[model samples]
Target chain A: MSELTLRPGRAFSMVERNLLIYRHTWPVLLAEIFEPMMYLLAFGVGIGVLVGNVPGLADTTVSFPRFVAPALLATAAMNGAMNETTFNMYAKLATEKTYQAILTTPMSSRAVALGEVTWALLRGTIVSTTFLVAVSLIGLTGTWTALLVVPAALLIGATFASLGLVVVTLLRSWQDTQLIQLVMLPMFLFSTTFFPLSVYPKPVQWLVEALPLYHSIELVRACFLGTGWRHALIAIAYLVVLGLAALLVAVRRLDRTLRT
Target chain B: MTTAPLIEARDLTKTYVTSEPYTAVKGIDFEVRPGEAFGVLGANGAGKSSTMRMIACVSPVTSGTLRILGMDAARDGERIRARLGVVPQDDTLDTELTVRENLLIYGRYFGIPWKALRERCDQLLAFSRLEDKGSQAVSTLSGGMRRRLTIARALINQPEILLLDEPTTGLDPQARHLLWERLFQLKEDGVTLLLTTHYMDEAEQLCDRLVVMDAGKIVAEGSPADLIERHSTREVLELRFAAHERQLMIDKCAGVTERVEVLPDRLVLYTGDGESTLAAVHALGVRPAGAFVRRSTLEDVFLTLTGRSLVE
Candidate 1:
C-alpha cells in the first residue's frame, strides 16, 4: 500500500466540508434568518410597544427590536456555531467515522480537528453575516457599527466550535445528548442572552460576567448600537483564549483516541 | 523489488488488560520481503486483527520490535504509514460522498494536488470498476461494489506495501475473484502485501508465504506448495460413506496409505499413489459411494498439524 499521514487538503475542502451538510439543509440555513426576524417582531414590535426606550444610554428613543437586535445577532452567531460544533461534529466523528476514513490516508488527527473547527467557524460566520444582512434589510441598526457584529459572531462561533469538539470527545453517544441540551439551554437562558445581567442579583451578575456567551452577547449588543469597543475587546480576548485552549484539548484527545 | 525486507517484526507482542488479561500476540517474528504476498491465516479472536492494526499504526504495540520499510513502527509510524496502504476489515468509506469524491478526498488527504487527484480518481474509479458509479453515494452501493471502491481508494497513492485485513471476508465469489485478480496485478507490479484471512483457499491462491495463527501464535508457516509437500502427500484421495458406515471404511483403510483420518461421512487418505490406495480399499470389499484424488492444499496441512477437531 501507499504511505499513510494523508495530506489534508486532498480530503474535504474546508468549504466543501461545512457546506456538505448546509447544501442539503436549506431549511436549516434559512432558519437562521428567522432568529433576527423574531427579535424584530417580538422585542422590536411587541416589547417596544410597552417599554418605549425609557432606560439609559442615549437621549433619543429607540425600538425594542433595536435593543434585542444586537443580542439576537450575537445569539444567531452562537446558535449557528453551536449546531455545527455539536450535531454535525458528532455525526462525523462517531456515526460516519469520516475522520477515520481521512486518517487512513495521510491526514493526521490535527488536520481533521482543525478542518472541522475551521469549517464550523466559516459556517458560523456565514450565518452570522447572512443574519446581519437580513436584519439590516429589516432595519435593525443604521450605523456601520452593526457591521462589526460579523467578526464578533465569528469569534463566538470559533470559541464554541472548539469547545463543542471538547464536549463531543467526552460525549458517550447520541443517548447522552441530553447533556448537551441540558447544559447549553441553561447557559443560553441565563447568560444574559435574552435579558440583561443588571436585572439579576449582583453576585449572579458577576458570575454572568465570567461566562463566555455573556461576553459575546455584550460585545454583539454594544456593536449593534455602536460604541462596543472595550467589552468587544474583552469578548474577543475570551474567545481567543477559549478557542485556543479548547482546540489544544481537542487535539490532544483526538491524538490519543486515533493514535491507539 | 528491493532486496531490503518490506516489513520486519522482531518478537512482536500485544497484550490487553481487562477483566481477563490476555496476551493477544505472544512475541512472534515476522517478515515480508518486497513483492511477496504474505498472509496470516487465523480463526476468530486469533489476534490477527490486532497485529494488522499495529502494522497499520492504528494500534500501538505493547512490546517487541516492528519495522516497516526498515523504519521503526514506534518512532516512524506516521512516516511509515504514509508509504503504506491499508484496507481495514470494516468498510470505513465516507457514505456522504460519491465514489469519485471518496477517491478525491482520500488522495487529497495524501496531499495530492487537485488536478492530479482528479486524474488519479478517474484511474481508480475505472480500476475498481466504479467508473459508472462515480456520482453514486457509497450508501447506495452494493457490498461488493463498496469493497472494490475501498481497494481502489487504498491504491490512490500507489503504496509500496499494501495491508489487507480480511479484505474479502464478506464478499461474494465473483467479487472475491475479481478482487483477487486486481491484487494479483498489484503483486506482479512488485507491491508487497501483508494480508490476513481465514480462508485456506485464499492463502493457497494468493500467498507466496503464509503463517497459520491459532490463538495468537504461529502454528505453521511456509509457502502453500512447501507446506503441502512437507506435511501431506502429492495428492488427496477422498472416500465417502453412509453416516453409520464411515467407521467400517476407516477400519478397512487403516494400512491402505500413509495415514487415514475418519470423519462422520467421509475418510481422507494421505497417500503417494491414489490408484493403488483406491485398489487396496476396494480389495477389502468396502465400497465408497464417492471417490476422488485431488492435489494437497494448505487446509490439509492445517488439519494435519492443528487437528480437525473443533478449536473453540
Candidate 2:
C-alpha cells in the first residue's frame, strides 16, 4: 500500500490492552488500592484520634480527613504509578522482551515509552478516582473540587511513571529493583506527604518542597480543600515540567537502547 | 520506481565495543529483489543475525550502507520499518495480550487506526491459522501457535519487505512445515523475503537464491541447485569398517574418486560416477556397508565453502 505510515499511538493501543490485563489481574490492582486505604484508616482515623489533627498542614484550612485524604490521594497516585511502571515495565522490557516485539513492527522506542507512561497515568487515574470517591463517600470531601484531582493525579502519575521508565531502562537486572524500594519509599515518607513542609526544619522543608511528590501533594491538597488558584497552578507547573523532562530523557534513552 | 529491491546491504559491518571491540557483521554485501526468497546461510558467530538486525532497522550499522525498500536505514528508520516485517530468531510476541490483540496492537504501532486494525487482525489470523486462538493470551499457546501469531503480527502492516532470522531454528518438523506453508503463501502474494538460516534443507526448500557465509563474508552465492552442481559431485559413497581394520581398506580405493574425505566414523568418496567407483572398490576387494547414488544438494556446496556444517 502506498503512503502507509505507523503512528506512535501503537503504545496507546496497549493502554487498552493493558487495561484488559488489569481487568483480569484485578487482585494486583486491588492490592495497590488497599495500601492507601489501610494508611487512611490506621493513620488518618485511628492515629488522628490519638494524636489529634495534623496542624499547620499545607492546606490547614481543612479538617483531619480532608488533610490526610489529599495526602492519601497523592500517595496512592504515586504508589500506583510507581508500581505499574517500575517492576511491570522492567519485567516486560527485560524477561518478556515486550517492546522488542513492538519495535519489530513500525513502532519506535518513543512510542513504547509514551504508551507505557500513558498506561501508568490511566492506572493512576483509576486508583486516584476510586480513592477520591471513597473519601468523598466517607464525608471527607469539602467541595466538588475533589473531581479536579483526576487530571492532577494524571499529571502526578505521568511524572513518576515516565521517571520510572528512565530508571527501568538503566537497570540491568532484578537486583536493581531494590533501588525503587530504597529510593521511592523514602521519598514518599520524607517528602511532606504525611505532613506539610513547615513541620520539617527550614532546610529540610526546602528539600521536601523540591520533591516531585511534594508538588503532587500541593496540587492534591489545593484541589481537595476547594481553594487556591495560584497554589494549584504552581503544583501543576512543577509536575508538567517534571513529566515532560522525564519523558524527553526516557524517549532519548529508549531510542538509544532499543534502536541502536 | 520499477520494483525496487526489498533489501540491500553494502559493506555492512556492526562492531560492539566495550573493553575490546568485537565485530559481529563484517562488511557484507547483497540484495534481495521484491518477492524473492533470499537465504543467508552461515556458521554460528558468522554475523547473520547482525546483518538481519541492520536490515530490520532496529540496529544501526557502525559502517557501510544498508537500505530497506529504497529508504536509508540511518535516517527515516521508522519510515523504513513501516514497510518492513521482521520475524526475529526468537518469538518476541507479548505474553500479556491475546493472539488477536497482539495483531491489533502491533498494527496500531504502524499507525493503522483502530477500525482498520480490527479488520486486518481477522485476515491475518486466518492466514496464520490463528483464528481460533485470538482471545487467548499468547502465554498459553503452543510453540507453533505462538510462532504463527508472530508471523501474523509481522504482516499487520502488510510490509513490502519481510526479514526472517533463522525462521525455523527451533521448531519441530511439523511446526516447520506449517511455517513454511505460511511463508510460501506470503511469497505468492509478492512479499519480498530475506531469511537467515543454518539449516540446509530449509534453504533448499525456500530460497530462490542463497549466500553461504563463513567468518562474516560471502563464500559462495547462487541458486541452491546451481551451487550444488558447481561445488559438489553428482553422487557420494559412504564407507565404514568394523573395529580397527581400516588399514586393509585404506589404499584399496584411493584412486577411484576425485576426492576422498575420512572421518572417525566413516569415509566419503566424491565421484562423478558412483557405479564405476563402486566397481573399482570391488576390484580392490574393498566393500562398504552401503552404496547409494543420490542427487547433490546445497549442504555439499555449503560444506565446500565453509569447511563444515553451519551449526558446527
Candidate 3:
C-alpha cells in the first residue's frame, strides 16, 4: 500500500480505542466543555455590557456579545482540537507509548495519524456545538447561516489538529509545550477574537492575517453573522489546503518516528 | 512430519541511519519452523531486539530479506502482522484502560468481531492466570501480572505465532516459572514461539533450539543439550581461591584440566569428570577456599563461545 493510503476501518479502530479510554475519563471531557463556557460567559456576556457594540463582519456593527460569541465558537474549536492533538498526542508519542503499541498491529502510521485527527475533530465539534447553543440561547445568533458554524468548526478543528500534531512532533520534553502556550495565548487574544482587526496598525494586521486563528475567526464569524459567502469561501480554501498539507507532514513524521 | 519454516531471514541486517549510522544486526541467517519454540539468546545491545522487531515486521530490514508466514516483511507487513502476536520488551498496556478492556481493544485492532473478541478475552485472561484481575487497571498489577496481561492481550486475536522479547526478564523466580509453564502449554498446542533472552536458564528451559548471538552475529546455534555437548565438557569444576593463590592454582590445574577459565574470583575447569578433577586438585596440595562440581549448562556453552558471562 502507498504510504499515505489508510484503511478507514482500521483508522476507526484507533477512534474506538480513544472512546474506550475516555469512557472512564469523562471528567476531562467535562473540563473541555466547561472551559469554553467560562470563556463565553466571562468575555462575551460579562464584558459585553461595558464594551457595547463592536465592528463585525462586512463593516456591520453588532452587539458586544454577538461579536465576541462567534469568535468564541471558533476559539472553542481551536482549543478542543489543539488540546487533543498536542498534549495528549505528545504523551502517546513519548510517555505513554500508545501509538508505538498501535503500530505493532495492522494499523498503519498514516491511519493512526488520521484517527487521532478525526478524534480531535469529534472533540472540537462537541465544544463548538455547545458554545453555539449557548450563544443562540442568549440571543447572539443573528442568521440561519449560523448553523453553518458546525461544519466550519470542523474545518477549524481539522486545521489546528493537523498543525498541532506537527508541532507536537517537534516537542522534546514537556517544558517545550509551554512554547505552544506562548504561541496560542497571544493568538487567542490578537486573532480578532475579542476585538476588531481594525484596532491594530497596518503591519500588525498583516501579521495577524497570516495566522491560522485569524482566518478561523473570520470564517466562523462570517457564517454565524451571515457576512458574505465569498469571504467564507476564501477562508475555507485557505484552511483546507493548510490542513491537508499539515496532515501529510504529520503522517510522514509519524511514520518516520514510529517505524524506525 | 517436518513442516516448512514459519519465519525466515537471509543476510538479515539492521543499520540505524541517524547522525551517526550504527548497525545493530549484522548479516545473519536463521529460520523458525512451525510449532517450534525458537530463541535468540544474547546479552544486551547484542541486536536481539532489533532482529525481533524485524521479524515482527515493525522495523524494516536495512539490507536483507525477512519473510514471515511465507510473506515478504517489507511488502506484506500488515498482512504478516495480522497473523502474528508481539509482546514487546516493555509492557505497553494502556494504563488508562482496565485489563479486560486492554485485551478487547487490542482484539478490535485486528478487526475481530466484538462478540468473538469478548469470548477470546475471557479465555486469554484465564490462560494468563489473570481471571480475577480482569477489571483492575494495568498500573495496579505487579510486574509479572503486567507481563502476563501483555501476553494475554497479544493472544486476543489467537495469532499463529507469538513473539516475546524478554517475557520474564524482571519477574521473580516463581513468576518466571509460572510463565514458563504457560509458554510450554502454548508450544504443546502447536503455536510457533520466537523469543529473545539474555537469561541462559530461560533459553535452556524454554527454547527447543536457539542461536547464541553476540555483536550482531550468531556465534553458536543448536538445541540447548546439543550446544552444551558440542561446545562444552560433560561437567565443570568451579574453584575459588585466594587472590595470592590464583596463579599458583592455575599453574597447578594446567596439568590435569584441558580447558580452564580464569575469572576474577574463581577458576572454572572443564572436564569429562569434574569429581576426578577436583580430587586431582586436592592431591596437588591446592586447598582452595571453595570448590564444587556441576553438570555443564548453556551458561558454559555461552562462556565457551564468547569468553564472557551471559548476564555481565
Candidate 4:
C-alpha cells in the first residue's frame, strides 16, 4: 500500500507537454469545437423551430434552443474529457510507450494521472466555452447566470476524465476502447441531455437521474435557466464526489500499472 | 575512509504473481562503485531487465535490501529516481514530438528550469549527434537516431548514475560502434553506468566488471579478462565436418582438448593451445573439412560456465 505522492510542478510539466502537442496541431481543436456545434445546430436551432416550448423551467416557459444549450455544454465537456483521457492516454501508455519515458524521470505515476486529467479538463473547458459563445451568438442565452455553465462544464469534464482514466488502466487493446463508445452514446442520448427526464417513465427517469452526466446536465441547465440553486448545489456535490473518487482510483491504477 | 557504493543490492529478488507465480530474479547480489561501468550480461528472459528495473526505482524489489545513491530503493524511489537516468530496452521517444522537444519535455519531467533545460537540450542533441535533426519528428528518424535521442533524453537531468537496459540490442554495426563511443565518453566524464546486455562483445567492450546471469541467477562475476581466464581456456579450435560426420568428429576430437562443444555447423574445441590442439587432431588421422583458431572471448567464458552458448 504505497501512498501516492504529487508534485504540482511535475504534473504541470505533463500538461505543458500536451500543450506543446496541441499547439502544433491546432486544427484538431477546431474538430472538438465542431462536434458540439453540429449537435446544437441540428437539435437546438433546427428542432426548436418545430417545438414551441419546454415545461421543465422553474418560472417561465423557454424555447427548445435555450433549454438544450446548457445540456450541450455538459455533453461537450464529457466528450472532450473522454477523448483525451481514453484515446490519448491509452496511446501514450501502450502504443507509444510515452509513460515509460516519463516514469524514468522524477515524475511519479500519480503526477502523470493528475496531469492528464487536468489537461482533459482544460480541453473540456475550452470546448464548452466555445459552445457557450456559439449559443450566445445565436441569441439563446437568457440570463447572466449562463456564464456559470463554464465552471459546471469543467466539473463535468473532471468527473468524466477521471472515469476515463480508470477505463484506460483496464484496457487490454485498442478494440476494447470501442466499449467506451457504447457507454457514452447511451448516456449521451438518455441522460436528459436532449430532453427533460420527465419525458421518461418513472423507473426510466430514476435510471436517468442516477447517471453522472445527469447531474452535470442538471447543474448546467440550472445555471442557464437562472433557477434552482439548491438542486444545482446537490448536483455539484455529486459531481465533486464522483470526480474525486474516480481520481483516487485512477491514481492507484496508474501507480500499479506504471510503477510495476 | 571508504566511500559507499553508488548501487548496492544484497539478495535482491523480483517475483511476478499473476495468474501463476513466476520468479524473474532469484535474489542476486552485486554492487556498482562510483565512476565504474558495471554490466549484467545474460540472454533474453535471464532477469537482466528485471534487475535493471529495480535499480532504476521503477520496479520494486520483491525482497531483500537494495540501496541506490545511498537511499533505500523501496522507500525512497522518487528521491533515487531524481538523481538517476534510465534508458530502457525499447526506445520510448515521443514519436509525436520533434527530436529536440523530446529532450526538452524529458528534462522538464526532472523539473529542470526552462532556461537551463533549453541549454541542456541543445548540448544533448550535439552529444547524440542529432544536432541537425533536432526539429525532425521522431517517427521520421531512423532506429539508430531514435535510440541515440533516447540516451540523450536520459542524460538531460545530469544524473549521477545512468542505467541502460539492452541499449544496443537492435542497432546496425556502425550504429552500435557510435553508441559505444558516446557511452565511453560518458564513462570518461565520470558518470557511473550500470547496463544490461546479452551481447558478449558489448559487455567486454564497456564493462569494468560484470556478472553473467542465466535462469535468473548469476553464474559468474568478474572483469571480462579475469572471467575469460578463470572460466575458459586460452584459445579455441573450430573444426567443421561434412554433414552426417559432426557427431563422429566430436567423438574423434574428444581427447585432443580440454572440452569440445558441438554446434550446428562446427565443433569448438577448448584448449590451452589452439595450434597444438589442431595438430593433435590431425595427428590422430582426422582431417577436418575446415579449421581455425582464435583467442577465447566472453562468449567462450559463458559457454564454459553454462555448458550453453551465449546466443542460444
Which run of 10 residues does model 1 chain B get worst, by summed lDDT?
B303-312
lDDT tens readout by residue for model 4, B1-312:
167899999999999878988899998998899999999998889999999999998887899899998899999988888888899998889888888898888878887778988988889989999989988889899888888988998898888999999999889999999999999999999999999998999999999999999999999999999999998888999998877666777788887876788887788988889898888999887878999999999998888877777777
Q: Candidate 3: lDDT of A257?
A: 86
Stretch of 10 with least lDDT, candidate 3 chain A: A1-10
True contacts kept of each: 0.53, 0.78, 0.63, 0.71
DockQ of each: 0.41, 0.59, 0.53, 0.54
Give the local distance difference test score of model 2: 0.81
Task: List iRMS for all predictions.
Answer: 3.8, 2.1, 4.9, 5.4
Scored by Cα lDDT, where does model 3 land? Answer: 0.88
What residue runs in model 2 are displaced by over 4 Å at the alpha carbon?
A: A6-11, A56-63, A143-145, A198-207, A226-237, B1-4, B246-256, B282-292
Please give the range of 10 consecutive residues that has the lowest summed lDDT in model 4 chain A: A1-10
Candidate 1's residue-wise lDDT over A1-260, tens digit each? 33333344532454464465455566876777676677667766787778776364453455666777777777677777777767887887788877766666556677778787777777677778777887788776788888888877888888888888788788788987778888776777788655556678899989888888788888887788776578778888888998899989988987776665
Ranking of candidates on DockQ, top first:
2, 4, 3, 1
Model 3: per-residue Cα lDDT over B137-206, one tens digit each: 8988999898999888888767799999999998999999999999999999989999999998999899
lDDT of 1 by residue, B1-312 (tens): 458888888889988766888889998887889889999988778789989988887777899999988888888766776788889898899776677777876766676667878888888888888889998778899888998888888888888889999988888999999999999988998888899988888888899999888778888888888888988898778998876776776787788787777755568898888888888889989889899988887778877877762233
Docking class of 4: medium
For residues A1-260, write the lDDT of model 3, one tens digit per residue: 22212356778887888899888876887787777678878988899889887854455578878777788778888988988899999988899888778878888888888889999998788778887887788788878999999999999999999999899888999999999999999999999988888889999999998999899988998898887578678889999999999999988887888998
The 10-residue segment of model 2 chain A with minimum total lDDT is: A1-10
Per-residue alpha-carbon lDDT of candidate 4 for residues A1-260, written as tens digits (9 for 90 to 100):
01113356679888989998988997887898888788888998898888868765555588888888788788888888988999999999998999988888778888898899889988887888888888888888879999999988988989999999899999999999999999989999888877777789899988888899888888998998888788799999999998899999999998898877
Output DockQ, candidate 1. 0.41
